[model samples]
Target: MNENQQSMPPETPQTAAAPEAAAAVSVVALPWYRRPLFWGILLFLGLLLLAGWLFWKEWQQAEATKASVAAQTEQWREHNAALESFMQQLRALLAKDPCEVKQGLGRITSPAGVMWPPLASGADRSDAVPQKPGDLADKSGSGRSDTPPAPAQNNADAQKQIPPVPVQKQTPRNVSELMEQATVLVLAMKEEGLAMGTGFFVAPGYVVTNAHVVGDATEAVVVNKAMGRPFAATVRLVAHDNGQDFALLGVDGTSGIVPLKLAQSVSRTERVSAWGFPGAVTNDDPKFAALLKGDEAAAPEVVYTEGVVSVILERNPPLIVHTATVSQGNSGGPLINEKGDVVGINTFIKLDDASYRQSSLAIVCSSLAAFLRGAGVSITMAQASESAGGKQ
Candidate 1:
C-alpha cells in the first residue's frame, strides 16, 4: 500500500517554463539563407539603394561636365571674335580709313563743303536750267554804233552750243547707298517693348525699321547676328505716314548697314518680293524658339514673300496691290523686285479669310519718299516755320 501511494509521483515534476524550453530545444530552427523570401528581400533592398546612389552621382558628374564644355566653348568664341576684329583694324590701317578720306591731293585733298542732297523723287530740273552765253559780249564789243551784224557762220556756231544739265541720281537711289553703309540692330522700346516692325541697314551706321517700332521707345536695343553683341541705338530719321500706312525709322551709329535698293514706281501685275519681320516665317528671337515656343512664333525675323501684283491702287496713296498677304509687323518693310530693288513699303492689308488669303498692300515707296521730302523739315521749311512759327 505504501508503494502504490508513493508512486514516484514525487519524482520531481518539471515546471511549466522548463517543459516549454525542453520542447523548443528539440525543434530545429530554419537558417536565414534557406528562407528564400528573407534572402530575396535583402537582395532587393541592397540593389535599390546601390542603383539610386549611382544614378545621383552620375547626374552630378554629367552636369559638371556640361558646364565645363559650355564655358570652354564660350571662351573660344570670344577669343576668335576679338582676333577677327583686330585683323580688320589692321587691314584698315594698311589701307585707308574713310574718316581720313581727303578730297583732292592723291585722291585725298579736302573739298569745299558738304553738298546738299539734290531733289529726291518728284522734281526734275533738266530743262528748267539756263544755258551759259558764250562771247556775246565780245560780239557786241565791236564798238559799232548799231552793233555790227554777226557773221552767219558765227551765229550758227553760237546757236549750236548747248549747256550741259547736271545728271544726278535721286534720293531713293542715294538712300540705299547710305543704308549699305549701316549696321544691323534689334529694336526695342520702353513704354512698349521690342520693336514691332522689321528693320534693315539704310545707311552706314543707320537702320531703317518702322517708325512705330521706335515711336514710343525711350530706348532701343541693337544687335547684329553677324556681330553677336547688343548696342544702344537712337532714332535718327522718321518717315511716319499713317495714311500711306508706312513709316521709316533710322537707327544711328551702325556701320556697314546694307540699304535695300529702291525701284521707280510700277503698276499692278508686277512680280515683287515682300520682306519683313512677319513673325510667321523666320525668328529673330531664336532663344524663344529653343524654349519650346517655336509654334507661337509664326513670323519673326527676316522673311520674304513673293507674289504677283494682286492689285495696284491709288485709293489714297499710290499703293502696290497683291495677294502676297502681309502681317502687321510688315509695315515699313521693303517690297523688292527681281532686281532686288525696293518697289514698295509693306504697309497695310485687308484679310480675305474666306479665301484663306491676305491682300497685299504697300505704299509706292519712291512716291512716299518724295512726298515726305515735299513736306520735309528742310532748312527752308524750318526758316519759314520760324518766321510763321505759331504756338500749337
Candidate 2:
C-alpha cells in the first residue's frame, strides 16, 4: 500500500512539471514582436482614444452652433425693437391731422389745401362748389347752336360756314362758375419761413393753399396786388389733403376784386409773364430798379418775368421741370401771359451748377384747378391759342 502511494505522488508531480516546462518553451519559441495579447491590448487603447477625440470634436461643434444662435437672437431682438418704435411714431403722426408739415418735413410734403383768400362773414364762398364737366350746352345756357345749320352740311363746308368769333367777343370760359384762389406764406418763427404755396379763391373770401403752409404760419396776410393797389385779405377755412401735399384756404374777397382767369390746355412753351409781390419787389440790384430786367415788367410792377413753360410732367418721373427764371420768394406767384392771364404758379427752380445759373419751373394749374373745383371752387380754361410749344 505504501509503494503504490509513492508512485502515484511522483506521477502527479511529473505531470505538473512537464506542463510548466512546455509552457516556458512555447513562450521562449514565440517571436518578440508576435504577441497577440499585447497587440489586442494596444488596439483596445487606440479605439478608446479615437472615440474620446470624436466625442470632444462633437462637443466643440455643438458649442459653436449654440454661440451662433445666440448672436442671431440678439440682432433680431434689436431690429424688432426699432421697427416697433418707428411704427408707433408713424401712427401718432397720422392721427394729428395737422395742416403744416413738422420741423423735419420741408417742401417734401404734397401740394394740397391751398387757398387764394381769407374767409370772412358775407365773403364770397364760391370755391366751395365743385365744377362739373362742361355740359353739351356750356354754362352760357346758349343751347346747342346759335347759328342755322349749313345747307347739306359737309364737314369741310360746315367748318367754313361757321364764322370764327372774335376772341374778345367770346364769353369767358365759364362765367357761371368762377372761383377764386389764395396764396399762403408759412414761417416757422425761429427758422426760415416754412412752405409757401398757392391757393385759389373759392367763394368771395375762401382761399386754398397747401396745408403745410398754414400749419406753420403764425399769422397769414393776403394781398391782391392786382389792382394797382395792394388789398389786404384774411383767412377762412383751412384743410390739408390726405392723399397729397395740398392745402385749402378760404378767404373773403367781398371787396370788388376781379378774379383772375385760369388757362386749361395750356402750352408747355407758353411765353408767360409770372407776377407776384415777393416783398415790395426789392431791387437788390439797383441797376434793375428803374429799368426792369425783362421786357414784360414795365414800371417795376411786381417783378414780372418772361419764361416759356418747360414741361407738363404728370406721368413722367424726375418731375423737375424747366423755364426761363424763378426765385425762392416767387413760390405762390402766378405765371401769367401777354393777355394778363394766369397759367401756373412758380414752384421750383433747377440750378445749372456748372454755370451757376437756374432755370424756372411752374407747376401747371390744370390739376390744381380741378382740385379747387372739387372743394366748391370752379375754374375755366380758355381755348388755347398757343401750340404745345413756342408761341407764334
Candidate 3:
C-alpha cells in the first residue's frame, strides 16, 4: 500500500499543474476587444479625447467672435467722428451775418429822408428871453392885455403852417397796409440754435420784439419788404423780468419803415388782427423756405389772422387772451385793433391740460407801454377816439 500511494502522489503533482495552466489559457483565449477591462480602458480614453476636442473647438469659436466684435466697435467710433465734424462746419456757416455780407457787396442803400434827426447842438440854439407875468399884463394900464390874444388858429391855417412830415409819404392808408409796411422778420443766433420771431417798428430805427427771441445774443437781423434787404440790428434792451418778455432792437437803417401806433387800452370782444411770419403759413411757402436757406434775396410775406379779443387776464404782468390764430413763429408779432393800433404783443399759446384746446396769449399794451417808457423808447400813443374813428 505504501508504494502505490507514492506513485499516485507523483501523478497528482503533475496533474495539478496541468489544470492551473488550462485556466490561464482560457483567459488568454478571450479576444482583447471582448474583454471587459480592455473595453473599459478604451472607452475612458475615447471619452477624454472627445472632451478635449470639444474644448478646443469652443475656444477657437470664442476667439473668432471676440475679434469680430472688436472690428465693429472700431467702425462705429469712426462714424461718430465724421458726424461730429459735419455739425461743427454747419454751425460755423450759420454764424456768418447776412447783413455784413450784403454790406460788403454794396447792396444796402440809404433812404433819402431821415426819420429821426439828431438833437440840435446847444451852440446852434438861441437862449430863451425870460419874461415876468406882469410884463405881459396891463402894460397899457388895462386889466386885459393890450395885444389881443392871437386869433384862434383854424384847422386850415394850422395845416398850412405845419411842415409836411417825412414819414407821411410812407403812411399806410389802412390796417392791411400798415402791417405790410411795419412788421418784420427777426432772426437771431442763440446758444440753443437759430431763433426766429416777429418784430415791428416802434420808432424810426427802433424795433420791438420778445426778449426770448433775442435770448442772450447781442446781434440780430431784421428783414422787411420795404427795405428789400436784411438790416443789421443790435439788442438795445432786454427786460430782466421774464414775465415782461420785451426786447428793444436798434436797427442799422430802418428809418424809411413806417412805425405803428400803440393803443393805451384794449377792449374785450374787440375785433383784432395778428400780423407775423407764422411758421404754419410761411413754412409751406417755397419762397420762405428759400429765405431760411440763406437766400438773402428772398422775402417772406407777412401773415395776417383775424379774430376777437376773448378776455384780459388780470394777473401780474397782465396778459391778453385773444382768438387770433397764432403759432410758433408768431412770437413778438403785433396784436392790433381794427384801427391799426397795436393793442398787445403776441407772445405764446396756452394749451388746456385736459382738452388740449389752444388759447392765444399776448402781452398787454399797458405793460408794453410801461416797458417802453422805462427803457426811454419814444412811442406814439393813440387816443381811444382816434382808434374808434380809424376803424374800418
Candidate 4:
C-alpha cells in the first residue's frame, strides 16, 4: 500500500487550481447581457415598472371622471329644487276660491250721469188714452165723441215734441272711448302662473286674445271697466298653429257693450294705436298687485301707445310689424286705426341683444278674420272707411 501511495504522488496546488480556473473561464465566457438567467431577472424588473406606470395612468383617469360626474349631479339637483318650489307656489295659488277672491276686491261704481224717470209699473198705457167722464159716456151712447178725439200723434211728431231725450251713444267715437267699453283685462290661470293679457270685444259676448296668454287653461276671467265686475269666461277656440297664436273667449253678461269693428286692409306708415295693460306700466306699481288680488278699489286703466306700421310681412298668416311700444301684457291687444277700428292683433316683440332694438309684431286683420270664420264666429267688419287722414 505504501509503495502504491508513493507512485500515485501527493496532490499538487496547481492541479487543484486547474479545475477552479476552468470554472472561472466558463463564467467569463458568458457576459451579463448575453446570459439567459441575467436577462430573465432584468425582464422581470422592466415588466414590473411598466405595470406600475399603467396603473398610475388608469388611476389618474378615474379621478378626472369622478370629478366630472360630481359637477353634473350638482347642477341637476339645483334644477330639480327650483322646479319643485315653483310647483308648490302654483298649487297654493290654485287653492284659493275664485269667488271669495272677487268678493275681497273693492267695489266699482257707475259713472255719474243724469237720472231718468222711472217707467210706469202697469201694462201698456201708451195706446190707452185718458178721457173725461162725460166723453166716455158720450162715446158709449152715440159711438162718437163731441171733441172728435184729438188726432192721434204720429211717432215722428211725438218724437219731435219730446225734444229728443238725451241718449247714450252705443258706438265709440275714438280709441280712447273704445278702451273703456270694449278693451278688457284677461286673467288666465295656468300651470305656470296667472297670465294677464289684453282682450277686446270681437262680438257682443266674445273676446279675442293670444293663445299663449290662455295656454292650456280652459277658462279665464274677463274684467270690464264699464261693467265694473269680473265675468267668468270659457275658452271657445284656440288656434292650433303656433304661427297663428290666436284664442277666443266667450263671456256671459257682456252684452250691450259695442264690439270693435275690424278693418279689412292695412297699409305701411299708417298711424296705429295699441291698447292693453302692459306690465311695464304697472309691474312695479304697488297698487297693481293689490288690483290683481282684488284688494284695490279700482281696476287698472288700459294703456295706449301710438306708433306707425313699420312693415308688412307676407307670411302664411301675414304679420304687421309696427313701432308701437308694447310689452309682455300687450299680447292679444288690438291695434286700431284713428277711427277706432281694429287692424291687427298684437302678438310678440322681437328684441335684438346686440343693438337693444325692439320690433313689435301683430297678426293682420285678414288673418284674424280667417281664424274667426274658420271657427264659425260672426265678426262684423267695418265698411270701406277712409284712412287716418288720407284716402286708402
Clashes of each: 29, 71, 0, 0
Q: What is the C-alpha RMSD of each candidate to the true structure, in Å?
A: 26.5, 25.0, 24.5, 26.7
Q: What is the TM-score of candidate 1? A: 0.43
Would you list the C-alpha lDDT of every candidate in the order shown? 0.47, 0.43, 0.70, 0.69
lDDT of 3: 0.70
lDDT of 4 at 309: 88
Report lDDT (Cα) of residue 135, candidate 2.
Answer: 13
TM-scores, in order shown?
Answer: 0.43, 0.41, 0.56, 0.55
Off by over 4 Å in 4: 1-173, 285-287, 295-297, 387-392
lDDT of 4 at 328: 73
Order candidates by TM-score, high to low.
Answer: 3, 4, 1, 2
Model 1: residues with Cα > 4 Å off, grouped in runs: 1-186, 190-192, 237-242, 245-248, 282-301, 371-392
Predicted candidate 2 versus true structure: per-residue lDDT over 1-392, tens digit per residue = 78777776444677669977888877646675698988899999999999999999999999999999999999888777766665455344433323231443332322223221211111222222111111110112122223443334463364357532211212234322222112222211112332233444433444444444455343443432232211222334343343233445433333243456666545555666655434324334342232121111112223545666676667311122546455544555566655545566554455554565666655566645666676776554555662133453
Tell me which of candidates 1 and 4 scores higher on TM-score.
4
lDDT of 4 at 261: 85
Which of candidates 2 and 3 reaches a greater TM-score? 3
Ranking by lDDT: 3, 4, 1, 2
Give the 10-residue window scoring lowest on summed lDDT in candidate 2.
129-138
lDDT of 1 at 358: 50
